[model samples]
Target: MRYEPISNELFIQNRKNFMAQMKPNSVAAFNSNDIYPIGADSTIPFQQDRNIYYLSGVDQEDSILVLFPDAPKPEHREILFLKETNPHIAVWEGEKIDEEKALQIAGIKTVYWLKDFHKIFHELMSQSETIYINTNEHYRAAHDTETREDRFNKWLKENYPAHQVAKSNPILQRLRSVKHQLELDTMQTACNITEKAFRRILKETKPNIWEFELEAEIMHEFLKNRSRGFAYTPIIASGKNATVLHYIENKHQCKDGDLILFDVGAEYANYASDMSRTIPVNGKFTDRQKQIYNAVNRVKKEATKMLVPGTLWAEYHVEVGKLMTSELLDLKLLDKADVQNEDPKWPAYKKYFMHGTSHHIGLDTHDYGLLHEPIKANQVFTVEPGIYLPEEHIGVRLEDDVVIQENGEPFNLMRNIPIEIEEIEDLMNQ
Candidate 1:
């Protein structure tokens, strides 16, 4: 791992919180993600499963975290099973986490090799009456491939037919939604790194520079600051490309007056910070661009104020839609009658702003959280509002990661990052 070690207390508290919610004599299991295959004899980089990482702080593949809070033996309450690294795996894929290292990384002292898992798990299963299985149940999830967690769930159900099954996803969705102080600090570090990258680009970006070059600059800054590159695949969209949400083919050369949409962020210690800022290729935005940018920025600010506790995700977006609708009307993109005559299902603002105003941001960029539930204090969300105009070749989105507060405004993690038009202009010119 490129990032420094996180304090064990965070994982300890996470485990304690999770265990408190579990039924008596029930054990919850979390599995590391598979190092997926790419082509012949090649494999994609191993990304640890966020849930296991959340509870155990174990970042390696083929690892298992067993949380048996009510185990007969105290030592068996929390155990970690790592893929046994021998000379062969070491030679082929480099040294994986050993027992001593795993113990330090995770707070668990009971560690075993993967080879002993079936036997040991079977013995443990004999004592456990219930099994808590985790599945990817994120609101936006569209997973097709079976994961390691899925396989284990199948194995457990088939082997222990009489055992009562429970869903771990629900518990995690609620728990992980709210941020711990440590988690918030980690995300702050990520946002700080992203701020550095953005500042660097503000001073460096000029006409004729390739969009990919800006992407490279952001990645360079992230890595130098102990971040493991982008939290998600960056979208360095410039010119008309910005109109296409999720545009990642950063091959176009930024023209003189074109705006570059940088949807980039950094990850530190497995925590994610999501940010989006649109800046001119040169030092200043055109009058039209400035108008649209300020409009979107206004919408973002207005939308963010509603992220306080007790706000429902559905209702929050509807309120944000009204904010966006007003902005579009101000931009002359929508007439008063256009909004009045629009379908209730798809508002007039949908033409300009399509995606949701916000989503939970944490270990995963689009982190797990129940949208149906009211927003809670300490929950982190990204407030992004954009206006895309394919006809005018303009798209402006301003986003920041914020923590919901009990009273007053939510705390903006990217508060240090320049957002004000004048601040951005000064930074660009300086």
Candidate 2:
């Protein structure tokens, strides 16, 4: 791993919290993600499963974590099964985690190779009455590929027909939603890395520069800071391209007087930071551009203040719609009649601001959290609100990752990143 080692206490406490919610005599298991294959002998880069990484801090493939909190043998309560490493294998690939290193990383005393998994699992399963199986239940998930966890779940259900099965997704969704101090610190590092990239772009950007060149600059900053790359595919949309929400074809040269919408972030230690900023190509926003940019910035500020505890995700967006509606009316995008006669199902504000105002942001860009439930403190979210005017070839979005505090306003993780029009203009010119 390029990132520094995380303290095992985080994993230890995470496991303790998860176990506290488990049914008695239940055995829960988590598997690492598969190294998916492309065509020919090549395979995609390995990404560790978030659940296993959360519980064990083991960021390797072919790893499994079995938590049997009520195991008959005390040492068997928390076990880690890792891929066997021999000297020859170590020469082929870099050294894999040995038993001692696994213990140090995961804070679990018991470790075994993958070869011993079936035999030990059978014994453990016989002693337990229920099994907690991990599943991908995040709201935004739409994958068709079967993951390693899915395959393991299938085999477990087929072989152990009598065992009572429970879903680990619900428990994990709630547990992982709130930020731990260490996790918040790690996310801050990612945001700081992203801030560096944004500042680098501010100085490097000029009229006639190709969008791909700007992308390269951001990648350079991220790699120098020990980040693998973007948490998600970056959207470097310029001019009318900014109105297209997911535009990623960064091929055109940024023309003078056009605004570029940058939806990008860096990842550190598998934690994610999401940010969106719209800046001018020629280092200065036009009069109309400044007007729209400041409108989005004001909406972002007010929306962030609404992220306090007890706010419902659904209701919060509704309130943000009202804020955006007010801005749209002021900008002449909507008149009084447009607001009065608008359908409640899809308000007049939807014409200018289409997407949701915010989403949970952490390990994943859209991190796991129950939107139906009331908001709570220590929950980190992205406050992103935008207005896209295709006719004027203008789109403006300002976003920041914030942590909902126990009292008063939420804390901004990207507070240091320049957002004010004057600050951005000064930096770009300087």
Candidate 3:
């Protein structure tokens, strides 16, 4: 890992929290993500499964975590199964985590090689009444590919027909949604790296520079700061491209009067930071551009204040929609009649501001928080609100990561990142 090691206490606490929610005599298991193949002998880079990483802090492939709190042996309560490392294998792929290192990384005393998994798992399963299997149940998930966890779940169900099964997703959804201070610290680091990249781009962007050039500059900054790269595919849209929310071609040349909508962030130690900023290509917003920019900025500010503790996610979006509607009416994008006659399901502001104002942001860009439940303090979210005007060839969005507080407004994680029109213009021209 390019990033520094995280404290094992975070994983230890996470495991404890997960175990607390498990049914008595239940043994829960988590598996690492597979190294997916592409075409020939080549394979995609390995990404550790978030659940396993959360519980064990083990970032390697072919790893498993078993939590059996009621085990006869105390050491067997929390066990880590890692792939055995040989000197020859170490020479090719660098040193894999040995048992001692695994113990240090995960704070689990018991460790075994993958070869002993079957015999050990059978013995453990026989002692437990229920099995908790980790599954992907995030709201945005729609993958067709079967993951390593999915394969393990299938095999377990088929092999042990008599064992009672339970889903681990619900428990994890509630637990992982609340941010630990350690997690917030790592995410803050990722946000700081993203801020540096944005500042770098502010100085580098100029009229006639191709969009890809800006992408390269951002990547350079991220790699220099110990980040793997973007948390998600970056959208470096310029001019009319900004109106298209997901535009990522990044092939067009930026014009003097055009604006570049940058939806990019850096990832540190697998934690994510999401930010979106629209800046003038030539370091100066026109009269009309400034008006729209300030409007979106205002919406983002007001929307952020709504992210207090005990607020329901569904209700929060409704309030944000009302805020956006008021801004749109002021901008003349929507009039009183437009809003009054609009459908409740799809409001008048939908024409200019289409997407949701905010989403949970952490380990994943769109991180885990149950949308139907009330949000809690310490939960981090992205406050992004935008207005896209295709006819005017203008789109403005200002986003920042924030943490909800027990009282008052949320704390802005990207508060240091320049967002004010004067601040951005001055820095870009300087």
Candidate 4:
């Protein structure tokens, strides 16, 4: 891992919290993500499953975490199964986590190799009455590949037809939504790296620069600052490309008067920070551009203030829609008649600002908070508001990560990143 080690207590606390929600006499299991294949001999980079990483802090392939808080034997309560390392494998893959290192990283005293998993898991399952299975229940999930966890779930259900099954997603959705101070610090580091990249682009952007060139500059800054590149694919959309919400081609040349909408962030220690900023290619916003920019900025500020504790996620978005509607009216993109005649379901603002104002941001860019629940303190969210005018070839979006406090407004994690028109212009022209 390029990032530094995270304290084992975070994983320990996470496991404890997760176990508390499990049914008595239940054994829960989590698997590391597969190192996917690209071709016959090539493979995509490995990423640890967030569920397993949250519980064990074991960021390796062929690993599993098993927890049975009320087990017949104390040693089986919390166990980690790691892929055993040999001398030849060590020489090839730089030392995979040895038994001792696994204990140190996960703080679990009991460790077994992958070879012993089937036998041990069978014994554990026989002693347990229920099994808690992890599933991808995030709102944006659309996986077609069968994961290691998915395969295990199928095998377990087929073999143990009498065992009661429970869902781990609900508990994890709530638990992972609230950020610990340590987790917040890690995410803040990611945001700081993203700020450096944005500042670098501010100075480097100019007329006729290729969009992919800006992407390279940002990646360079992220790597130099110890971040593992972008949290998501960098969106260096300039000109008409900005109108496309998920534009990531990044192969177009930036024209002199066009606006570049940069939607990118860096990841530190697997925590994500999401940001979006639109600026003119020449380092100055035209009069119309400044007007629209200020309008979008105002909506973001007001919407951020409403993200404090106790706000219901669904209701909060409805309020944000109203704010966006007013801003669009001020920008002259939506007329009064358009709003009155608009469908109650989509609303007039959906024409321009369609996506969303905010989403939970953390380990995943669109992380694991349940949208139906009330907001909580220590929860981190992103406040992103935009106005995409395809006809005018203008799209202005401003986003920042924030932490909700027990009292008063949420704390802006990306506050140091330039957003004000004057501040951005000064930094770009410097």
Candidate 5:
């Protein structure tokens, strides 16, 4: 792990909260993500499954966490199974986590090697009446590749068909939607690293600079700050490229008198920070660009204010649309006739701003939160508003990650990052 160690208490509390929601006599299992193979003898970098890492703080491959709160033996209540570290593995792949280290890292007293997993899990299944299986149920999930967890689920049903099954996704969706203090602190670190990268880019950006060059500068800053890299695929769109919402080719050279849109964030310790900012390549926005930029910034501010407790996600978006419509009217992009004739399902503002204004952000760029439920305190969200004009070859988006407060306004995690036109222009010209 390049990032500093996270406090084990976060994992402890997360496990406690999740177990509390489990049905009586239930055992839950979480599996580590597989190290996907690209070709012969080579594999993609391993990433621990977020669900297992959330409960155990164990970041490794071929690891498993099983929670059996109703187990007859006290040690079986919480168990961690890790890949056995032998002398050969030590020499070739470095030392894997041992028993004592797992205790310190995950607060689990009973640690077993992978070889004992089949016998032990069978014993656990014989004793437990129900099993909770972790599954990906995020609103945007579209998984085609089978995962280690999926394979384990299939094996579990085949071997132990008598055990009643339940989904862990619902419980996790509600629990993980609310952030713990330690999680918030780690996300703040991620945002701080992203700020450094953005500041560095502001200084390096100029006309004829390739978008990939700016991306390289971002990676340089992230690596120095102990972040693995961008939380999601970064979008470094310049000029008309910015109009594409998911532009990531990053091959175009920035042109003078054109604006560049950056939808990028750095990840520290697996916690994600999502940020978006658009600025002129020439270090100053033209009058037309300023009009669109200020309009988007205004919408972002208003939308963030609505992310308070008890605010429904669907209704909040409708209110944000009204705000954007007013801004579009002020910018002369839409007239009274356009507003009256627009479809209610797809408002007039959708022409310029086609995407949602906000989404939950945490371990995943589009993290988990039940959209139908009302917003809550400690829940983090990204407030991003944009106006894209492909004909004008201009695109402007301004985004910030904010935490909903128990009262008053939400706390902006990216407050230190430069978003104001004057601040960005001054830093770029300096």
Candidate 6:
């Protein structure tokens, strides 16, 4: 990991909170993600499963975390099974965490080698009446590939058919939705890194520069700041390309007067920071562009204020759509008659601002928060509102990550990053 080590207290508290919610005499287990293969002798980088990392702070592959608050032996209550390391393996793949290091990192005293997992887990199963299996139940999850957690779940079901099975996903979704102070701090670091990249690219952006060049500049800043690059696949869309919401083929040379839309972020300590900013290729927005940008910025600001506790995610978007509808009417993109005759299912604003206003942002770019539930304090979200006009070749989206507050409005994590039209123009001109 390029980032600094997180305090073990965060993981300790997370485990305590999760265990408190588990059924009595139940054991929960989390597995580390596999190092997926790309081809022979090559593999994609290993990313620790967020659930295991959230609870145990174990960031390596071939690791498992087992939690049994009620156990026969006190030492077996919380256990970590890690791959055993030797000098030869160390020489080939760098040194892995040992027993002492694991204790320091995870605050767990009972650690075992992976080879002893089945033997010890079977013993625990014999004592426990229920097993809590972790599964990916994120709202956007649609993958077909089996993960390490999935395989572990399958094995546990086959071996312990009599044990009552319970899902850990619901508990995790609720728990992970709200941020710990440490998690908020780590996410701030990620946002700070993203801010550095945005500012650097602002100085480097000029007419005729390839869109990929700007993407490269952003990546350079992220790497220099100890971030592991973008939280998601970056969208460096320019002009007409920006109209395509998920545009990532940054192959176009930016033309003068065209607006480039950047939907990019940086990851620090595995926490994500999502941001979107649209700027002029020549460091100055035309009158039309300025109008569209300010409209989107206004919508973003108003939408952020609605992210306070007790706001439903779905209702908040509907309110934002109303705000955008008003903006579009003022901009002459949507007539009063157009909105009055619009379908309830697909609002008139759908023609321009199609996507949702916000989503939970954290470990994943689109993090885990239940949309049906009311928003809560410490929940981080991205407030993004855009107006895309393919006919005019203008697309403007302004986004910032924010933390919902219990008292007043949501706090913007990207507050330090320039978002106002005047500030952006001044920095780009300077």
Off by over 4 Å in 5: none
Residue 318, model 5, lDDT: 96
- For candidate 2, the 10 contiguous residues with the lowest summed lDDT are 97-106
TM-scores across all candidates? 0.97, 0.99, 0.99, 0.99, 0.99, 0.99
Query: Which parts of model 6 are misplaced by more than 4 Å?
Result: none
- List RMSD in Å for every model shown: 1.4, 0.7, 0.8, 0.9, 0.7, 0.8
**1-430 in candidate 4: lDDT tens per residue?**
8888899889889999999989989999999998999999899988889999988889899998999999889999999988988899988898888768877888898999989999999999999999999899999999899999999899989998899999999999999999989899999999999999999999999999999999999999999989888999989999889989999999999998889999999988889999999999999999988988998999999999999888998899999999988988887889999999999899999999889888999899999999888899999999999988898889889999999999998999998999999988898888
Once superposed on the true structure, which residue ranges of model 3 sit more than 4 Å away at CA?
Answer: none
- Please give the range of 10 consecutive residues that has the lowest summed lDDT in model 3: 356-365
RMSD of 4: 0.9
Q: Pairs clashing in candidate 3?
A: none
lDDT of 6: 0.93
Q: Looking at candidate 4, what is the lDDT of residue 334? A: 90
| Pairs in clash, predicted candidate 4 | none
What RMSD does model 5 have?
A: 0.7
Model 2: lDDT to the true structure: 0.94
User: Which digits, one per residue and each the tens of the lDDT, describe model 5 over residues 370-429?
Assistant: 999999999999999999999999999999999999999999999999998899999999
Looking at model 4, residue 163 earns an lDDT score of 98
TM-score of 6: 0.99
